[model samples]
Target: MDTIVYAIPVFMVMIVIEIVTTIIRKKDYYRLNDAINSLSAGMMSITSGIILKIVEVTIYTGIFSAVALMEFDSSELWVWLFAFVIYDFFYYWTHRMGHEVNILWAAHAVHHQSEEYNLTTALRQTSSRFILGWLFYIPMAIIGIPPLVFFTVGLINLLYQFWVHTRHIPKLGWYEHYFVTPSNHRVHHAKNRKYLDKNYGGVFIIWDRMFGTFQEEDEQYESIRYGTLKPLRSWNPVWANLHLYSDMWKDAKATKSWKEKLTLWFRKTGYRPADVAAPMKMPDIHGYQNYDPALSTSQQLYAGVQFFILLLGTTALMAVYHTTPTWFDALWIIVLGANLVMNGSILEKPEQAIKLECLRFSITASALAVTATLMPVASIFWLGLGSLAVLSLAYLRRYSSATEPTAAIES
Candidate 1:
């Protein structure tokens, strides 16, 4: 939470800097605001995962603290430094596995969704890392690093990675061969087949070098195509996760055999469409691709204003709910993770998903209110907000899906 608090101000400064630089260069691209909004969806997904991890770890500690009893009672900086390195090692492997495994890719895919690369792209992180990421840190627990120290270092490592997302910074001199820099990270985000799974380092590129997964940003031979092999046409956060899943599901269902259906989920994306047709040609997707800035001034301005307001409101909401949970807080997390998915579901040409997500959000919000009242968090605050959530959801559901959308709502 402290890390989240600190990042708020940092995000503000970088956003401003990104804008001024873009405008000064007169480089045409989509509004930086749209890119930032996309970042929010990315962060929301990450936040939800964070809350879930807190809940799980609290449970893990509560249950295992006794069995895994420790003798140490206080501070030790050296131990923490050692722990940080160990944690990074764990992160390297987990990050690598995320790319290799299909299930893990679903969660990591959020970061790669942005068609453009910029400072905002750095903020585009996954919403589902907490689902399985904590398992990687169990070694720290086994080694007896206190939970407080573990959490602090994890936050520090995350904060460290955010700045490396920008293209504004060139290679970090000789340090380029040592730590993870913006140039190295650019390669990590690239989808060029050669750069696909390289540069899997957290703080130090040494790990990648030692592990043989390191790839330099080759200007001539190996270029970069940002974003995923598949594109997310809409802006809805909720749909981001489910869109691919839904596509896979539809294709799987259409398969002739049960075995084929079962394997489809594990196969590479776009697999089950099997004897896949010829590849459709696409644009460069990086260094001035996708939404052209020269052509989209109005949309960018609108999205920028909309996001500023939404984030302000969200920060206020977090403050209001500060007293709710001592164990785990999922309020903002849900908003960030599900917002896009819900928005996307609603926007599909068919309209069934939009209706379904509204219903789901309504049910979940109301149930949460009831659960809060019945549990330790029985504040009058949640009850009222939950009621508001229910009503707001109902009203949103009133929109007619029969008509073509005037604007894109889902990401």
Candidate 2:
């Protein structure tokens, strides 16, 4: 059973509850643009997962079948419990190394792009994690951990981490010492000098405490600063995923020595070629602000409406994804990815957003046309699309006057 899929409703409910609670408390934690971007990145991660999961399962299955150390029955409760702990043990190392290594950080950095820490921030996972992530769990396969056990425990571990990405929850008394709570995980996400590279455990905080990577959330010392040292100024999901890799590529190309180029990726996190590395300056945490391009009411409406529509499309895609041909699945991913890119542009209020949106709408319309020509599409879909397009243009026209001056929404 895909536990994560079954828990989607619960996740949505929790997010809504968090939003309402924060509002009721007279504190603002969720920003519309950041939340949308975070969710969009998560959507991309799911879409990518649909394609990459096959490779992951194949590799794990092949290795397990080839080397049968000892067949452990997954039906036993102890087996399940042991699998949970062991999987988390490996996850700690995988997550820790993800921060320490360069190429791995390229994929993991997407989760840290959002400056705001909220429930949606937890969903901002990397689409490329499957590339090297499987390496961590290969040990489980060698130890004869059944695939079913691994899958279920992995999902359980992930679901356990979801609730910790909020500020509403205070530290638990004794529970804080053993398990990961909101307080400790907040330190994990902090970019402050005192808290960097701390609290790498998933379900258990004991691992970090044991390994000396644990940092307590001390109010007297320094408040937590979320996000990486280099801010992701743009909201594009695709760029969010690839920006670090792009930086690494440029650094590699600029270096004179081949050894430097080859080893740059494997080197410590934030290590750049001497020629490329800028002088380190203390980060102005107080001056740091969230990236908020002043979006007009109409622009915000357009983004919200289109994103809702795309969310529907994404849900539909997930429903039929497994039944569809591989090509159609790939096409669905491309269309959705492009939508996210254009949506990011709209949020940024870039000059090119207009052109990009036109191209995006045209692509969507053309895809519908092609799809209709190939087979019968429901009339309701066409009706919805036509209504949405008309409403979008009307909103844009009505709100055009408000966009003359770009106002940055200060954090």
Candidate 3:
């Protein structure tokens, strides 16, 4: 049982509170497209984790079973505390290396892609981190830490990092020295020359302090631009995960030497072969603008409603993925992924989004209708999906004309 499942409601409540607080303070911290895109990325990560986590746990458990150093008593308080602290220590290196290494940065960059620093930015995660991230925690298994203990501590460490994504929280005097606070974490998310790759702790700031990676949020520097040096200018969730890898592949193919092509991903972050490396101008930190595609009121409402529907679908998929049949689980995952892609497309290209939405809704409804007759699915499920499809199609049809071409936005 993932503890994060239980914390979803709490995460939503806190996000709402943060939004309200920012509104009351007149601080422009959140943007609709950015938040929705962040959450879409998060949904992709969680849904993909339904399968990825099993592989992670299996590997971790197998390692622990094979090399038993000395098992600690799981019931002991000290064991939990020690595991929690040690987990952060390992997380520090994992995070630090994520900045230094190119391939690792490709996965980690998803979290920092959002130009706006807010609660949703915390939810923004990479689905592909499981590719290499699991290697970082192998020492825990070697130390005979129980899988349950390791998992719980990891979740706790993750939960602790969420609140620190907010900008509303100011610097805490002495507390900032010990824990990963919003002030220090802001420095971590910053793309500024002085703040890049600093403060890599998950929960404790001490690891960064010890490793000489800590940098305070400097007041003298112009406002910290929150994003990668190479901006991910689109809101497409699938593209968000694939864009960096795609760039690397293109770089590898264009490189003159085979060794440079093979070793490109392992090179330092932002490394490119000289032949393919084009001199690119970095965005002026003081004048950087976030990626915000304009959408009419109707289009915004359509995207918002469709997003909420997909959110419910994602939540349901997360809840029942283990107990469901493999094919059914795969089907839901594909549909949900398609939903995310369509939602992002809607945001990026509103002119043609309604047609895409209608096509998606029609296909989904028709599939559900066919599946219900062939399987023992509950009547309520059919009714709910059927109603959603019908209503969504109607809504799209009603607003199809409003989303007409004005200016084409790049995706």
Whole-model lDDT values for every prediction: 0.62, 0.84, 0.84
Pairs that clash in candidate 3: none
lDDT of 1 by residue, 29-140 (tens): 3345347546667557545654456665774465447545463333877878886888788889888877776656777788778876777776777666666666666666
Quick one: ranking by lDDT, best first? 3, 2, 1
User: What lDDT score is found at residue 84 in candidate 2?
Assistant: 98
- Model 2 scores a C-alpha lDDT of 0.84
> Which window of ten consecutive residues has the lowest lDDT sum in model 2?
373-382
Q: lDDT, candidate 2, residue 41?
A: 96
Residue-pair clashes per prediction, in order, are 19, 0, 0
TM-score rank, highest first?
A: 2, 3, 1
**Candidate 1 weakest ten by summed lDDT:** 291-300
User: How much is 225 displaced in model 2, in angstroms?
Assistant: 1.7
lDDT of 2 by residue, 1-56 (tens): 23345566687789999999999998878888999999999989988788888888
Candidate 3 segments whose C-alpha is farther than 4 A from its true place = 278-282, 366-384, 404-411
Candidate 1's TM-score:
0.73
